[model samples]
Target: MTMPHKTIPESNHAKPVNLRIREDVRVLIDRAAKIRGKTRSDFMIDAAYRAAEDTLLDQTLVKVDAESYQQFLDILDRPPSGAGFERLMNAPKPWQG
Candidate 1:
């Protein structure tokens, strides 16, 4: 008798990634994955995710808990201060011609 398998739920926000690497780099990737007992795709995805998380943490981001989230929502509910906006809007454009 065969055992029944459960189906995994699908994700809605999947994005396709395609990258080109040099031949030497491809060889190095295979070697690294073999040493770690992980597939090339797994290693690459893990590395990319770590790099992405680091980048987001280094930027101007507002992180908050549930209570703070409500406060944040209320803050955004108000109008903008027009901070640095006028300078950018009225700034002279460089000559492109």
Candidate 2:
């Protein structure tokens, strides 16, 4: 006798993902999750999903005409110097200290 098998809908199916992280890192993640009012798994998944999206988006290349390309190069060669740039350059270096 063959027993009937039940299938779950694709959307309702989830696979287990295991990770090994340091205790300190886990504590940090837990604190952030608590502040956000979400479980650690949800917070980690959201962060990982966003990072994957950003990685893909960063790899996108746009086709440009030669004249526009030269303009971009010019801008890069001589970035505008303003108060914002000065402030950023003069900011305290906590890491160095």
Model-by-model lDDT, in order? 0.77, 0.85
Q: What's the lDDT of the predicted structure labeled candidate 2?
A: 0.85
**Model 1: per-residue Cα lDDT over 1-35, one tens digit each:** 86863323346987778999999998999999888
- TM per candidate: 0.45, 0.65
Candidate 2 local lDDT, 12-78, one digit each (tens): 5678899999999999999999997878988887788778878999999999999999999999999
Could you tell me which 10 consecutive residues in candidate 2 have the lowest summed lDDT? 4-13
Q: How far is candidate 2 from the true structure (C-alpha RMSD, Å)?
A: 11.7
Stretches off by above 4 angstroms in model 2 are 1-10, 78-97
Clashing pairs in 1: none
Clashes of each: 0, 0
Structure candidate 2, residue pairs in collision? none
